[model samples]
Target: MFNTVLVANRGEIAVRVIRSLRALGIRSVAVYSDADADARHVREADTAVRLGPAEAAKSYLSIPAIVAAAKETGAQAVHPGYGFLAENTAFARACAEAGLVFIGPPPEAIDKMGDKIRAKATVSAAGVPVVPGASDVDIPEGGFAEAAAKVGYPLLLKPSAGGGGKGMRLVHQESELDAAVESARREAKSSFGDDTLLMERFVTTPRHIEIQVLADTHGTVLHLGERECSLQRRHQKIIEEAPSVLLDEATRAKMGAAAAEAARSVGYVGAGTVEFIMSAHNPDEFFFMEMNTRLQVEHPVTEMVTGLDLVSWQVRVAAGEPLGLTQEDVRLDGHAVEARVYAEDPARGFIPTGGTVLAVHEPSGDGVRVDSWMSVGAVVGSNYDPMLAKVIAHGPDRASALQKLDRALADTALLGLGTNIDFLRGLLADEDVRAGKLDTELVDRRLSELISSEVPAGFFVAAAMDRLISLQPTGTVVDPWDIPSGWRLSGPGGITFRLRTGENQAVVRVEGTPSDASVQVDDAEPVRVSARREGDLLEVRRANGVERYRCADGPQRTVWLAREGKSFAFADQEFTLSSRGEAAGAGPVKSPMPGTVLVVKAAEGDVVSAGTPLLVVEAMKMEHTVTAPIDGVVTELSVRVGQQVALDETLAVVSAAEEKQ
Candidate 1:
């Protein structure tokens, strides 16, 4: 085993790799950009190195900087943990040229498997069934239309150079072909520096399953079973599980064999994943999608089921060790499930959110594991991926695993930012999901029912009581006129608070002190309410029952409360008003989230109809298009392409059309 290994990544993956390195008694070196100077991974590693500025192109993705850091730190091996440079063939070759071991596959294997077009051909030649598709190279000039037609409708356009649902589009008809192709090409070029594309037949009812394979320098390859990654949003996997309930033992053996063959065909070594698109209706049929040339985001579930440390094995293999076990020696112990916790708001179309983490409560106990990089005061920005942590649970059976996962999510509390925790719990509780009737489209189909946009009344009551407590005098002597205890000579006295969350606003009224008060929320019947602050937790008692909430005070008089996996930030209405105190109207086009304007579709003074795309704002690799709210002329365009914007900042003004004389 190598004495020192450089982790060429950031966030939770980096932290996870460092953990395994520590377990194996190896000194781990962590690399960070300017944005991650005080990040959790940096604090955990044995040694830290600064790459460059926050911009990924100048830092995390800088091959020379990473190689130099590894050499300077005397790291004999470099582990590209999942994202930035994990699958880059050039990065692999760079490490080799620098005389440092790359703890992954050889450059030739990575080059062959990194490109989806070449991977498909290679796997097919190895007798692994592949999806029917056509790449740009497979067709003659001006033959894209003809090739697409032959592949049939509802086809998928995927970037040949990269994966992760980036630069992918689904065309259901010929009318949408041109626009889809153009958008796919643009995104592909932006994400992978390649505009090459491939077309594939879209499976109507698809279940994404991938086989985890490990190979050694001695040419021994083994499969670690499959993971069900069907629960997805925006074509990205949000929930994943090992030992899929959809596959029987017979089918599992076949898929595992095929995955092993695919790896062998490419001379693959170290850890890799062979992804397959299996039809939900026809369980026996499966098609090869592509092969990831490095460790996967969902590798934890596989590790839980197989009882193997994939990272440790990757290191041993990179050290030219022979296989220590055969295929028959592997075992699937129990079911395991993983839910990705991202800094995103599911209620707002899953847009990426950013803020300072005021508090965090990760779940623990039996059969539970949390890989997280979150810490109090950690600043989450739009410069990197929005994922903050992963909550995984293991159990004797699938039902118990799912139940444990839901309970674990309910115990999670991340304050001062919007997250998908509540949404994940709701998804796990869905009837169809619990029954294992899963498909790639299940989340999309049940999204409306799973998302809860309405703020619970208890939150408002808690906020009111918290405010009432803060207003109490803290000195030994208090002035009568300075007291805000809602005490008066009249029959009844009350104090009202106007709180706003997102676009929704509510007025909460409180009478008396925090220990005993009558609270009314937005014209609702008054209810007896009392609350006490205990450290970061607020215990509130109401007519129904007692509820505990993790609470935190944020900047600009924002009160954050979290309970049962749900988090809400309520800003004081008085402080939320604009400088002029003018009410917002439909004319202002505001950015939905903080990001950079990727494209300006409409110019100033241009007449546009309602729903016309005016600009595209991208953050954390996700793009959200801002559109005209009404039929009007763009009288004021405040933003241009590549300009950074904040949430709710006006990008343009669309004045309503003037009436004719």
Candidate 2:
């Protein structure tokens, strides 16, 4: 066992690895970038070191800096936690050259599986059925069209050197082949520094299933069943589960054997996973997608369902250990589901959200666990992936696990950032998702309908009422402006507040004393509310739910607290009232979420009809287009190409057009 292990990553995964190391009596060291100075992972480690700036290239991805940190901290081993330099063959070899153990497979395994084209060839050579595609490694640009045609029109162009849906494109017809290739090449270059691509048959309505394999240096390898990663958005997984609900005993056995074969063929050691694209209609039939030579991001689900800690096994295997349990000894119990909570918005193209975390109150209950790397004041930086946390729930069966997940999400409270908590709560109750009849493209098709699903109106009403009840200065007595001598005013006297947080805003009016208040969001309706200030706490109710807020001597701030599942936020000076006192919200057009604009779909003086795409914004690994509100000329364009914009900053303004014939 290593006396000290250095983690070469950041965020939740690093924290997760550290916890497992502590369990095995190993000291842990953490390295951080400028943006991650205050991150939870840094604070949790036994020792820490600086890596550099917020950009990954200058910090986490810097091989020399990480090696130096490990050596300086007296770390005997380096654990690349799933990303960054985890599968970089050069990094693994360099660690060994520096006389530090790399707690994963040998560099040979990494080199074999690092390239998608080579991985497919190797797995197929090992008798595993890989997806049929071109054998060419680097086909010329002009030759790409011919190869894609040979593979059939509806095919996929994927990067040659890695996975994660990066640099991947689908073309349905021959006419679209060249364009998809160009885009794929650009994306490949930007993401992995490699523009080489290969064509493959596109899997339709596929379910991503992976087998977790653990091997030791003593020539022992074992499989831990399968995980269903079918629920995805833009090729990124949102939800993953173990012991795939659709897999029968026979199919499970076959896939497990195949996964084991792949591992043994490569002489794989430590924790690894073999990913496959299974058909939704027939889960038994699957094709080899790729093999990951390091710990996977979605490994926690398998851990929860299998009653095993993969990280512990990885450490044990790397230390010249043997597999204690045989394949027959492995048993998977109750169903487990993991929902990846991200600092993103589902309503507007799932763009990344970066802001100060004002407050957090996570839910605690049976069969629920949360893995996060955020604190109340931590900033969601642009230096890494925007995942907030991974919430996992285990139950006796699928239905029970799902129900527990819903309850857990309901109790989660994270304030001061735009997250998908509310969106997740609604998804758990969705009929198609509950029935398990979904595919990779499900979210894309059902996104609008899912966001439009009604959130508990009471939660919103209570939040508004709480703001009205708690926004008073200290040592101020009520009823000072009464007309009669020391008289109390008759009827309810309310004050309206315009509260805006990015693209979403609220207009709230509250009146009367803290004991009894009337709250209204708009003139259309008025809600009778009761507020009570007990000591330093204030609780108000205008509807079915009650909101509690703590008052402090500071500028006007709205503290948004949600139960565990719903994403919430709080703001102080950034949320300012408009000139006319209306909320600082805009019209039908929406701006990017702190992202760089790639293309302006509509230009100034360009006459456009309603619903025309106005601009295209790329942020946080996804692309979204803003559209025209009504038929009108693109007037007063304030933004140009290659410009960055905040969440609600007006990118453009449109003039209402004359009626069309």
Candidate 2 lDDT tens digits, 1-661: 7899999998899999999999999999999999888789999999999999987789988999999999999999999997689989989988999999999999998888888888888889988888878734656635767777778867878888766776677789989777677667766775667888888887888888899999999888899999988888767788888778778899999999999998887789999999988779877689998899999888988998888999998988888888788999999999998888898878766778877877665666889988888687888844467788888899989899999988887766666776887788777777988888778888877888778433344444555555654555456565565411123357655666565443455666666655566666555476777776554345666458776653222125655545435544434323544556322222336576776676777777777877777876655444556778767766667888878777767887666544211
Off by over 4 Å in 2: 135-138, 453-460, 476-492, 499-507, 532-539, 542-556, 561-564, 567-591, 597-618, 621-645, 649-661
Q: What's model 1's TM-score?
A: 0.97
TM-score of each: 0.97, 0.88
Q: Number of clashing residue pairs in every model? A: 0, 8
- Give per-residue CA lDDT, model 1, range 419-490, as digits (tens): 999999999999999999999999889989999888888888888888888888878998866668645677
Say which candidate scores most in TM-score: 1
